[model samples]
Target chain A: MPRPAKKPRKSYHHGDLRNALLTAAREVLEERGPSFLGLREISRRVGVSAPSAYHHFPSRDAIALGLAEQGAAELATCLAAAPANPSGSLLTYGEAYIAFVRANPALYRLMFGEGFPAVSQHSAAIRALRERSYDIMKAGLEQRLPASELPIAGLFLWALVHGLGLLLVDRQIVRDGDLEDIIRRVLTLAGTGLLHGRGRDDGQSGPPPPPPGTRSA
Target chain B: MPRPAKKPRKSYHHGDLRNALLTAAREVLEERGPSFLGLREISRRVGVSAPSAYHHFPSRDAIALGLAEQGAAELATCLAAAPANPSGSLLTYGEAYIAFVRANPALYRLMFGEGFPAVSQHSAAIRALRERSYDIMKAGLEQRLPASELPIAGLFLWALVHGLGLLLVDRQIVRDGDLEDIIRRVLTLAGTGLLHGRGRDDGQSGPPPPPPGTRSA
Candidate 1:
């Protein structure tokens, strides 16, 4: 693909410089991961001078924090927009959450403080946005679970989606089948519990009998 | 704490050189992260020449792969060592798995190809060790679940522990409470399912009745 001609510096209004720098930083983040999110490179990509980029971002970490904030806000929006069926809302939220991470792998990592260690520590806005996302999950659970169970229940759902999303984005798990189907199945397990024969002898009475076709009559 | 004096170069026999380099590399991985796992720095820490380090590990990536293999083996051992109880073995495994990651956060990240993207792609040995660990979990599940459900069931357990560990290590979740208690509760929820009044109206009726002491009625 041809490199689009760099936008001339004059084309970026003063108010637009920060967004342009963030946009370029995101590209670098996805392409090279967080370690390569250098200010000079981002500025070069934006066709802006270093000092001009500095005026908006100050440092690479600041640019990363900017990206993180943007990611957090977008993620909150995704979670909020998930269909709110009382019984299946978590599945919808989990799907939306993973979908967002799948679409913006690097940005999701950045939001979680992957490369910039201080982003989480320094950004109250990010923390609030993160809390908002968590609240969405907790609110769904609150309808059914006791208040005392909320923390662990919320954490369970969070960890399930969080781990599943990372495993998918990181390609740590097998990808031979449909990714969305895999996600739904996994979340369903979380919702319904994985153990079979729930009330029958602690569900550990050994594997169920093999299907009729597989065994000699 | 004072820095330890560097060992003399002559002290390292050829056979010991590889181990010494790996030890220093592990330290670097923990103190910094994978991005800082440079061969030169590791050699300097080990008081060996860069060429000597190169002789053992052909490149920085080779060193990372070495670390990843080491981490994978250690994790598999940890998982294998988890006690096998038909009913509670997964909780034990999950505890052991999270314990390993908590103890060696950086190595765990490297094992998952955090900084060394090619480590997972290039190291068949690492992949095998990883598979060995997963097999341990699947073995536990196989006793109860049918063969057809193994894939999703196994992935669900993996994602739960994987996500819980990363959240703990990343400090993405609140840390005021006992982490072990939190992990136990979350895994127990996985074991028992989170919904209240299961098998009754889909468990989504509403919040349970207020505790006896809390209600004024």
Candidate 2:
């Protein structure tokens, strides 16, 4: 009543096969999209038989986890370069974070979008890579929020930046030359939730409303 | 050098064909996923020929736009039911928004996820429906923010709630019972950027941290 699953053929200990497949998978994700990915296509690109490809990734989802790990590691590098000042560094980190997604939208979607494997499905290496990225954000938020508010604060800020990045990438809102300007205003508002006082020092706020015509994106 | 694109056969008006196809497409989106959608399969389910299906939907993307319209309309209904108080209403809207996404994840992804057509590509009907949903949020924010800050404030709040909904659906962060408690706290913080005064006055703030063994999700 059902077809049998395909199995890898000609198995051998080629230590680089996994890495090779991962490289090929990332390329596929970048060029086409998540939907266009296939183990057969990856095998063809890598000059290997489909069965050999299956040695490392039993299904398309397995290869997706590999690509997601690569994406997480790259994001970690971006956040790692954030400035040492927690408040100031978060703005920088937010810029870098949003830029990273804009630059590699397809890969970012693979890592964070639906259809990616769940936590229980992630391998140890993948899990650690993902956590490392979140930890960087958590470390920064710990400085600004009370211990009791850390979790909610983390979710709030992460959602704000992440949502902005997605909106920009989706082209729902167009930002001309003022992406960083918008980011600064947004993260500032997110940090202090006020248009005056502490947030005012960031240069994104003022007591005077725009004199009728001026507008910020 | 290339095969010709397939054309819809025998164009004839079916009074309710468009509506019927959309209903069927939604069912497919709910059962399988975006990737599994195909006009031919939809036609088979609807007892129509492939050419007949094409008369209603020229391409897969055309059908996707139809589905996205349905999703946006549903979202508008949820937001429209918000309570009258701007601040309090936003929290209720956030809970409803997140719950909607969680309940219809596949449809939500179809509407907002990548591979869906861009806004410029949307028809007049589709664009209006999408904007109608956003207008509700903008109107709610108008009550609390200065007119000059409305656009930025709206974007900030949208991204925050959107991000939270995505994260919760993605299961990146686990919130146990009483999702509304978390939603109220997060929105209050976003509105005031403080754990005291504005955010604290809502009964969500305290000088003392959680008892030693307690933890927030």
Clashing pairs in 2: A192-B193
The fnat scores of all predictions, in order, read: 0.48, 0.46
Q: What C-alpha lDDT do the candidate models reach, one value each?
A: 0.73, 0.65
Scored by TM-score, the top model is 1
Cα displacement (Å) at residue B136, model 1: 0.6
Per-residue CA lDDT of candidate 1, range A90-193, in tens?
A: 66777778888887776776666445765746489988898889888777766555444567778888999998988887787875998767887777667675
TM-score of 1: 0.83
DockQ score for model 2, please?
Answer: 0.23
Please provide TM-scores, in order, for all candidate models, with all chains considered together.
0.83, 0.75
- The prediction achieving the highest lDDT against the true structure is 1
For candidate 1, give the lDDT of residue B114: 46
What is the lDDT for A137 in model 2?
Answer: 75
DockQ of the candidate models in sequence: 0.26, 0.23
lDDT of model 2, residue B166: 73
